[model samples]
Target chain A: MNTAQHGTWNRLFLAWLVAAVSTLGALFFSEVMRLPPCELCWWQRICMFPLMLLLPLGLFPLDPRVVRYTLPLALAGWGFALFHWLLVLGLVPASAQPCRRGIPCGEVGIQWLGFLNLPLMSLLAFSLIIALLASTRQKVSP
Target chain B: MKQKLLFALAAIVLLLGFFLASRLHTDARQEETRQHTALNQANLLRMHSPTLGPAEASVVIVEFFDPACETCRDFYPFVKELMAAHPGQIRLALRYSPFHEGAGQVVRLLEAARRQNRYWETLETLYASQQNWVQHHSVQLDQVWAALQGTGLDLERARRDMEDPAIAAIIQQDMADARALRVERTPEFFVNGQPMPSFGRQQLRALVQEALRTGGN
Candidate 1:
């Protein structure tokens, strides 16, 4: 009802758009590009993909209360993406890879600039989306 | 103030994406151009590999396949169709990657058959009847031999040559080369040394088309 909460709509919608793109990107790599998704990547996707639908429903009426529902999911997705990136970077060990397929999860099918891969890109995207959502929550609560 | 920060970060994400897309586009173009030059001007054929097209063909498909791989069996007809359709314009250089149990022995037999000039027949027979020899958990060499009984191959000489160190060495070389190219799965392809960016017959066909555009018929 107040001006402070009015612009939470911007943050919420943009974060939703990012989550939407992230979901589609994951599908594009797996389905279109024929790259297999690792288990951790799948967990991150499980956490992130629902936001694509849930956030928009929250935004239809521009409710600041959406933070109660979205933040936890964003946080969880961000955690998974961070862990997956760590596994891909070899900052963690192979024993931690957690997948037993013919192809290893940490296998660098696409490496760029010596430190960037799909997982890292995913981590960065979720982090931004989370930051935006949390900022909206800060303005929304009191 | 919050909106400003959010929009600023969003702008950066969008800009980073554009930068990556443009850089990748340039890199792919450069790489394709490099391969086009090699295909047009150089000879990269493997003299010992089994082939299914004319030597003077402008487009060449080099496929690394395993006889026992289910995916390779699935792609067999598609690769055949590509060759059949293009006739002399598309050539396929078949490389062996024996990924399953006893696949190396079968590859050895194929090589041994090559010595007797029955390479194509043996490959066709093995692929056509892949189920008889390649089992769920094991390979039946006797069944494979039985399948080859009337194909006019000298079974005794094939058995002897299968054990030959020279035959073993070729298998070793092909495996080494596949690893160097990071071929993780069966039916991996390179069109005139242009690697498919993804796994699909359509990707292979597109790369072949690109190569033919440069190399010419």
Candidate 2:
């Protein structure tokens, strides 16, 4: 209702939008395009998928405490995405790859628009969501 | 206020329904692509590749593998178990894609094992102890020979046959087929002439199961 709360709500909503879009994009790649997610990808998905719905549920009446609940998920997803991106870029050693059984984490299955691969896209999505959530938290605290 | 909240929920539900519906069409679309490629690219899928399982099995799994590749070694037992689990429904054709340095020598050794009617045994032995024989993505021929010894292969004869020009030609042909199929990595799989929509044991299993359901026709 207040100006600060209204602005925080906007940030929360934007973070929700990013989560929603990222969830759908992940589904499109895995379900529609039939690209199987690796172990790290699955872990990131676990963190990102719930925020899509949770954020909106929090926004229905505008709960300021929502940031407390969602921030951890976003941060964990960000970490996984960052590591996956590094692995894809060959910055991570092959010996350190976590996905030993199924699709190797290092393999770049789908590259879009010439340069953007799945891991990089995931990292970007998580980064945006985390950034939005961080700003929302800053406004909600005081 | 309640109407606005309901509307948003409905919109999300609608989008979710659309994605779920699209999933039903995915298999058909993939099957179409598989059939098209299978028909036009039969030559690329088959060669003098070594095969396992019954000759008339309906489902054929064509695998492009590097003998020295760690992932390929990791998958060998799993593939065998899958074939066994299906009981005459699946066949496997293995093509060499010796991408690792000095891997061709291992492939040649494997080819020589075929002459003594011990191809699969030798391959299994080598894969089981692959970590001992492959170092830093390169094949250690002496270690590989040591590993193969347990398979009862005549090492002297195998060494002599490893130099046979025919073995080199097989590797050359397989490498060419690998290139033609755009295989960039080891352990690439094609079930019933359909490359995995993506890499993963689960994906490969699903493709194989689908092929089995269709009787591979």
Q: Which stretches of candidate 2 lie over 4 Å from their true place?
A: A1-7, A23-142, B1-29, B44-47, B52-63, B68-92, B99-102, B134-140, B182-217
At residue A45, give the lDDT of candidate 2: 94
Residues A1-142 of candidate 1: C-alpha lDDT, one tens digit per residue: 4677566887887887788778767766775455788788788888888887788777666677777888888888888888888887789888877886566778777878987888888888889888888889678767
**Winning model by TM-score:** 1
B1-217, model 2: which lDDT tens digit per residue?
A: 6535654775577588657767666767667757656764654555477899998999999899998898898888889889999999899999989999999999999999999999998888888888998888877888987787656789999999999998899889888878877777889898877878767889888988999999988
Enumerate the candidates' DockQ scores in order. Answer: 0.14, 0.21
**Which RMSD does model 1 reach against the true structure?**
5.9
Local distance difference test, per candidate?
0.79, 0.84
Best by lDDT: 2
Range of the 10 consecutive residues with the lowest summed lDDT in candidate 1 chain A: A25-34
Model 1 TM-score on a 0 to 1 scale: 0.66
User: What TM-score would you report for chain A in candidate 2?
Assistant: 0.94
